[model samples]
Target: MAGKLDRFEKLINSLSTWLNWVAGVGLVTMLALIVADIIGAKLFKWPIPGGIEMVGFLGVVVATFAIAQTQFLHGHIEVEFVVTKLPKTAQKVISCLTYSLGMALFALLSWQSFEFGRTLQTSGEVSMTQEIPFYPLAYSMGFCCIVVFLVLLVQCIMTMIRAKK
Candidate 1:
């Protein structure tokens, strides 16, 4: 079971790494677009059309898509002073609980985001400036949420197993 869990962890880490790379690309693209828009607006007295909208979309991509990788890396902030003082088993229990809570929250977020995306799709909702469809980005958010939720669920399971041992 440990071996299986480790292999699953490796697979999830690989997928999260790929998502992080894609998020990096999105960030770079957003930066380039913003720079170009600034230059065009200031120097050429003509702003790049839909530049803001494009950057906004890319920002969502960069932020949402990196969440799974960030969780995998344990990059999020933690207040460990109290947890560290607890016995090892207690700490593991607390960790499991925390991860369970996180999984639940993200799962809810994923479901709600998917529903919102569907609503947007049905309504033909779009950005005012670029007329860019909103559903795709919402769907991306939902996907990312699922990825994070899966990561947390795995962590919760691992913690429970460790606590038992």
Candidate 2:
């Protein structure tokens, strides 16, 4: 059981690393697009259509997809004042509980986001500027949320296991 769990952790870590890289690429692309748009508007006097909307979408993708990596790196915000003073066992328990709640919240958000995306897709919703379909991007956000939730769940379980030991 321990070996299996260890293997699962490794798999999740690998997947998170790949996702982090993808998110980094997305961030860079978004930055480049924004800079180009700015330069075009300021210097060339020609702004790209729907540039803001595109950047917004890319930003969401970058942020959401990077969540797992952030958690894996312990980069998420932590109010550690009390936690840091607690006993090791208590700290582990609190960490497990915190992550469990986070998992639940993200799961709920993913479900609602998916439903919203489906409704938009069914209604053929499009962005105001370029008439770009918004549903696919929304659904992708939901998918990223799901990935983050799964990563949190794995972390929660791992913490529980460690607490036992």
Q: Please give, for residues 106-125, the per-residue lDDT of candidate 1 as tens digits.
A: 99999999999999999999
- Candidate 1 displacement at residue 38 in angstroms: 0.8
lDDT of each: 0.92, 0.86
Q: What TM-score would you give candidate 2 relative to the actual structure?
A: 0.91
Cα deviation of 155 in candidate 2 (Å)?
A: 1.5
Show model 2 residue runs off by greater than 4 Å: none
Q: List the residue pairs that clash in candidate 2.
A: none
Note the clash tally of each candidate.
0, 0
RMSD of 2: 1.5
Model 2 lDDT per residue over 67-155, tens place: 88898777988999989998999999899889989989999989998999999999999989989898987787788777778788788
Each candidate's root-mean-square deviation in Å?
1.1, 1.5
Candidate 1 off by > 4 Å: none
Worst 10-residue lDDT window, candidate 1: 153-162
